[model samples]
Target: MTEFRVLIVDDDFHVARVHSTYVDAIPGFTALSPVGTAALALQAVHALRPDLVLLDLYLPDTPGLELLRSLDLDTIMLTAAADPESVRAALRRGALGYLIKPFAADGLETVLRGYARYRRLLETPGTLDQAGLDRARRALLGAREPNALGRTRSGTETAVLETLASGGLLSAAEVAALVGVSRATAQRYLAALADEGSVEIQLRYGATGRPEHRYGLRD
Candidate 1:
């Protein structure tokens, strides 16, 4: 499979490093060195020509939305700006997806995978029929929407959810130990809940090694 090159544009060095690690961890995706300013981002885009950009709204030189207008490449807004106007402007300027900051560890991964699928669907040679077109559209749009995990919940899933609701962030291993399930099983449940917007995933970065992924109930 061809790797999808991603460019991350965030002013904060630590945040950019975290996002770069996240992008590289996903299969078939690789991140270029992140840029802190819109000017540097523009230069990187012109030079590297990445397949996608993870853009932040606040930049040192230029506003990310304005920068989006200037770039022809695909972009997803990753920002701390949660204002309605900012969201509306980003969508209007053709942002592929909008992810609020402090999102789960899997958040960018979800969007990146969706974009990869979307690109694959539309990039195939030949004219697309209505169904094909719809699938491609859904591949792009569905990633931004909350998944329909349905109202019914399994006993294990309910236990996982309840456990998260009761307290602070918990790792899958911790949840598994508490709920009497395998770590993989716990992860599956937590991921499903996160997709449904019922749970939040937080990454705790340390001085060394990979960041720890912790789960909590969304307020």
Candidate 2:
């Protein structure tokens, strides 16, 4: 089996790092690159043509939707907002995975595992037969529900906020541990609250390394 190549495309450096970590740790995953800008992401895709592209719906230089127009690889659409319209748009555009920002890392992993299987099926004769397609649809739908540990995330967004309130600020990884979900999942809720002006993100520069991001409730 070939080492699966991946490209992480997101504006948030911290979020990209977390995703990069997950990809690097996966068993069959090969090298994964983090590209913060859409222009560079396109260039990387054209050159490497990774097995997967984790894409954000919004980018600084270009709309993510436009970037979607070009890529032919299996894409995991990353969205900051969980709006139904945005999700529907990704599906219509053939996104293999639709991840709401701060989606649980485990959840993303599970989906990727499924995608790996689905990719295998692509090599099988007549795998896309209507029956197979229906089964795949059902499987994807099943992934939409919360797992045992992730049940809390299905609760009100305010509930997620309460956990983050314990201290002044927290990284998505720290918040995910507190809530018992993947860091990615923790980020979605945090980003949403931040967008609503309920929370503020502070970039903490360290003594010797890259800066870390922490989120706190806005007073």
Candidate 3:
């Protein structure tokens, strides 16, 4: 299993470091030198020969979308720019994934993992059958559906997410009560959300018994 070399491109030194650290912690990825300007990014991409790039839309020298249009490497957009026009332009210009800034490391991890799966599928040997082709397509273009849960999108999942997004810690029981679902069902949804890095989890210790699990949206 070869590690994917990634270059971090962003104007803020601190944010670039944070992204680099996240990439470093993942098992099959490595972060190359972080660059703040689009010119430096292009230079580093040529010199370092990284396999992937995490690009920010707002750059000091050039627009990130302009850079994306120029580069042939696999790219993922990681920017605080959440405008619809920017997102549409990035996708139209061939960004493989987009992670809005102010996102948790878990969120980035999930995206990277999905990207890895997509790469693996494409690198598979020989002719691809319909199933294989479909799997690869889902891996690359199915982020909103067939989610990490392996279940169809549902109102229940949305409700659970909204309840947690209200900004407080909750147990499965509490989530169930609020979402009007059974405890088992709530636990299933919460566990799936945690797996996708959409939420964070912690063990809360009680006075005399075993610790209980608590879930909350990542801060």
Candidate 4:
């Protein structure tokens, strides 16, 4: 395998550091700047043009999905937010992978290994027959999942996500009602969902009282 370079982008210093360390520690990989902001992430990609990017969807300056649309580099979203819409949106914007936050190094390593293998296979000489093309299509949809889906420790949070996905977007109270959970439980789930990469938290303007933060599927 050839030398692989990666850029780690996240708002948290420790998250970036830990991810960067795990990436660099992999043999035959060279890690470039592990940056903290969306701007720095873009700069690193443009200047260094690393082979892969471990991206965070939430950044201090810009919405993470927008950045993915503008860049030409291969990227994987590594984030705490697990909003289903966000996950689908990132994939639509052309992110190569999405790994939810709180992932261990083992998950990261599994993705890296698969990506590396894919890269190698990609470089191999090939002639595309109809069968080969058809096979490729079959393989593509099954491609995003890592070796396993990381278990989410929060159950109410998962139920809340299901509700939001069902309704497209819902106010906190609506979410609470749909999930058949208490308002406080719904609020906790929303925060947890925001952290897990499954749901998006946005403020709905022109609300009756308390500018309601609407829960939407991440996009």
Ranking by lDDT: 1, 3, 4, 2
**58-86, model 3: which lDDT tens digit per residue?**
99889999999988999999999999999
**Native-to-model Cα distance after best TM-score fit, residue 86 in candidate 3, in Å:** 0.8
Q: In candidate 3, which residue pairs get closer than 3 Å at backbone N, Cα or C atoms, i.e. clash? A: none
TM-score quality measure for candidate 4: 0.60
Kindly indicate the candidate among 2 and 3 with the higher lDDT: 3
Report RMSD (Å) for each prediction in the order shown: 9.1, 13.8, 10.3, 18.7
Where model 1 places Cα greater than 4 Å from the true spot, the runs are: 143-219
Cα miss at 4, model 4 (Å)? 1.0
lDDT per residue (tens digit) for residues 123-205 in model 4: 54676666434433333322422212476446675676667767566887888887898888887767545433355555555
* lDDT of every predicted structure (CA atoms): 0.84, 0.71, 0.83, 0.72
lDDT of 2: 0.71
For every model shown, the clashing-pair count is 0, 7, 0, 15
Better of 3 and 4 by TM-score: 3
